[model samples]
Target: MLSRREIESYESQGYLHIPAVFTGRDICEMERDHEFMTRHWASSGQGWTGPWRKEYMDAATEKQSQLVAMHDLHFYAASWMQAVTHPRLVEAMGDLLGPNVELHHSTMHTKPPETGHPFPMHQDWAFYQHQDGRYVDVLVHLDDTRHENGEIRFLAGSHAQGALEHITCTPEGPCTPHLPTANYHLKETIPVPARRGDVVCFNIFTVHGSYVNRTSQPRRLVRLGYRDPENPQLGGQSHGRPGLMVRGHRPNPGGLHPAYSSEVGALDAFKAVPEPALVG
Candidate 1:
């Protein structure tokens, strides 16, 4: 949990970065898990399951790598979930929002060295459904993030109001589709940088995006999602294949299942969940 001052900083600044949220060892383990999945994951057969399935590795890896994109959902599995859903994270969000929250989603993002595209600026909840008035997202950096490497940049406090409608992108720049003029203007443009163990938390309605990675190193991070538990899943068919939470509850009951939930541990607590060789 954050100090009173820290929460105030988040309220005022619209964002917060908890540094050293993971360790170098933790990062190494995650990367190993990723590489193993990539090398062995059949480009032509079946798919991944269990721990890796969340958008934070919550889904599946495509059979082949597409140009400028190499996404593999649920790459880290439940272990990654533990990192993404750390207690401090839950406590922080609880303070900002409330206690009745559930794991909405999670996604692991990676920009390979020298080959990642820019993510256009936009609002998250505007795209996803949320009945509740409040929703939160946390990004855990697996490496040193920086502006040159295409770190996240957001307009502060835009989350206060609801979604800004019909914002369109044009050759001139991003603009709104309707109305006499644009209410959109950057209040603050800050590049969120953090070490391997750091986590960046922000509001769902905030306007944000990251540019293309220009550096020579891979940029990777885990995006963990939390929303009010009562928010029901809206009826809709996903264009892409989807992963549904069959059933479960928080504070994992254990039984060799990756999706099980458990209590949040110490801040420095991080341990690798064992698995077979990435290649079957």
Candidate 2:
């Protein structure tokens, strides 16, 4: 569990970098599972392809840059299923998001050696919109991260400003939302270099991004989104889907979610039951 001072710091700074939260054994198991996922799963390029990316990376680096990513590790790997619900992480989540902490989602992000992709400055809110800033993104580092290896950078106390307007990439085929390159510069943000087993936690509203990895080694990290169950998600990623409880019991059980619709596409989510609770 985090100290009261640490929790206060996170409340004030809008982010907290916790070092060596996972043990060597834990990392080894996760690493092995990640390797297996790389081989079995259909990982794809999830790099941000917008004009904002150009401002963060050079033309040559941009061409070579690629991000290997996949969502929801729990479905495939038991090791990760256990890792996401690790006691230490759950305790931290409880500390940040109150007693009842529910997992919104998790994703594996592996930046390949010497040309890893870059992300533009933006809030996770554009992807998953919650009514409040209670959602926390916990980044579990499986490998050491440095400036040369695309360490995540955050604008200090930017979460205090709440969600900002994210623009779509016009020329780019898919609309990847990001803040304007003119205002949110990479140089102005603070880089957070972390070691293997370290976990960084920050509010979803916080503005953050990363650069291309220049090292010969891969930078692996798993992002787990945990939030207060009562946060009431509006839309975006994991919309209307039920979340796994990692800490205390969920508030107001057996209720309708906003993502539910009469459309057949929402059938599974609509039929989901609260009895077989996924308690972490």
Candidate 3:
């Protein structure tokens, strides 16, 4: 999946871009299905909107700006399920995080042509935070991306500082937990252009953002968040949900882990309440 040099690079730099991890044909099929999936969510107010959105768009641009997305594509599309669980991807997770890797969540991050919105500089730690630094968020690219098309940018080694406080805006959107514009500038980050079938992996605490996609083609990326089994979440998206383990089995370290919450609590509650008498 990754060599020792690459792993060291990711550890020191807090990000790594591995090219052509998937096949062009397979990714194309997944992209096609992504289109198929979005149709179901159309007219569902799926695009970005809210008071905080104005920070990234002017009046005219705001009127045209749009970002199409959804969460947990594996639930809806089999191709995506296979794509995320691809041997290379899961193995890479093992290489970076640990032998036991678990998936935190997945989300669609497709940017439609011309009017695609830009994401402000921010750390993912703000959205789905954890107690430790053994987590990573991977971007599986289904289309070629470049600076002109708003490729993702990273402030190298920023994750070494650990999670920084981000400006909390609306409940959702690209910049829901963005950095203040006054200090963190987008141009200061290094752009990471990638091609179709490429995958970019970054630490959840790395400062990252992108510019608007001005091209007439869509910038397609599906985000897959993964972590080692022992690194539990403090509180954020999908908190208390012990998700799928991709590499090794989820380790039981005792004491109230999300993995045991449902099983343990349910048994205790059942014992306390006692079984109800059989009814017709």
Candidate 3 segments exceeding 4 Å error: 42-55, 169-175, 255-280
Stretch of 10 with least lDDT, candidate 2: 258-267
- Cα lDDT tens digits, model 2, 21-64, are 88878789888989999879937574766777667667887777
Tens digits of per-residue lDDT for model 3 on 14-132?
A: 99999888896778778778889888852233264345456667778778778888888887888988887889999998899988988888898877888687888889998888988
Model 1, span 1-280: residue lDDT tens: 7778877877766677777666666667666765555456413222221111122121222222111212333443555545545566667767766655566566656665553444445566654645544667788776788876778877777667655664444455654232112343222457787777788888766777665566777787667666654453342222122332212333332322232224524321222335322332
State every prediction's TM-score relative to the real structure.
0.63, 0.90, 0.86
Ranking by lDDT: 2, 3, 1
- Model 1 TM-score relative to the real fold: 0.63
**Clashing residue pairs, backbone N/CA/C < 3 A, model 3:** none
CA-RMSD of model 3: 4.7
Best TM-score among the predictions, by candidate number: 2
State the C-alpha lDDT per candidate.
Answer: 0.54, 0.85, 0.81
Cα error of candidate 1 at position 111, Å: 1.8
